[model samples]
Target chain A: MPIITIRLAKGRSVEQKRDLARAITNTVVEKLDVNPEWVTVLFDEFDRENWATAGELHSDKYGKGFGKIGSQEYPK
Target chain B: MPIITIRLAKGRSVEQKRDLARAITNTVVEKLDVNPEWVTVLFDEFDRENWATAGELHSDKYGKGFGKIGSQEYPK
Candidate 1:
């Protein structure tokens, strides 16, 4: 069983999560030769305040919100 | 930098989470030679409905709650 955990800045919709879960499951099953039933996809959402890069919290660098529209590194 | 994600049944208190984060951070920093500030620990809480074992949903198999008091596999 492959347990995958994805970390992202919060604000994604349930539809996005559903799509992500499906895509990840498919990839893992194909690559690792595992059953879909054995794959676990976990989304670990982060508040900007709790996430940091280069010793600075994301809230200080990015203000708020998510995705690549205004992000310096993380792309959509 | 190492990003760690912990998947567990929901209902842990903030105090428990804080302790776990500290312990994990220390271990990662020591083992992986990473700075504590560069390590990220994310807790991914799951509902039993979303977790399954042996092709059975955890909710159906374990009922509710967390930890090992009544769990067959997951120990405290």
Candidate 2:
């Protein structure tokens, strides 16, 4: 089960997201040889204030630190 | 920007998820005093085949390692 979260620049449409998801599913099905239905992807479109990097935030990435997404994970 | 992922037991209902999300958002809004709209959460549900813990995968946690989400991240 390879669920990947792609955080791209916002403003992407639903069609673009579906295309990305389909392409990813097809790649896994072809290369790793897995069923397509098992592949699930979710696109979370958030305002820049929801993500953060370093001491600054995505909001600050532009100017003011309005919103930011702190992308950190712990393997457990 | 603190985007937290809750890896809970599968089979949670849409209502349960919405409740949890709302609770979390409220907590941050109350305790941390963050904005509501700035809080974005996504629920990733799989058939115990898309998440991993340590060496064994979630699927292997049941039987075979059908799928695995190797939760790892780098502090950038």
Using DockQ as the measure, the top candidate is 1
Docking class of 1: incorrect
Q: Kindly report, for each predicted structure in the order presented, the TM-score of its chain A compared with the true chain A.
A: 0.86, 0.64
* Clash totals in order: 0, 11
Q: Model 1 compared with the native: what TM-score?
A: 0.52
lDDT of 1 at B30: 92
lDDT of every predicted structure (CA atoms) = 0.73, 0.49
| Deviation in Å, model 2, residue B26 alpha carbon | 38
Against the true structure, whose TM-score is highest?
Answer: 1
Which residue pairs collide in model 1, if any? Answer: none
Point out where model 1 deviates above 4 Å.
A69-76, B1-6, B11-44, B47-76
Cα distance off (Å), candidate 1, residue A56: 1.8
TM-score of each: 0.52, 0.41
- Ignoring the other chain, what TM-score does chain B have in each prediction? 0.86, 0.58
Q: Write down the lDDT that model 2 would get.
A: 0.49
Q: Model 2 chain A — which ten-residue stretch has the worst lDDT?
A: A67-76
> Docking category for candidate 2?
incorrect
Q: lDDT per residue, candidate 2, A1-76, as tens digits?
A: 4454544335444665576566645644543334676555555556556655676666656543222333321112
lDDT of 1 by residue, B1-76 (tens): 7889888988777888999999999999999888899999999787655554433445555777777634444334
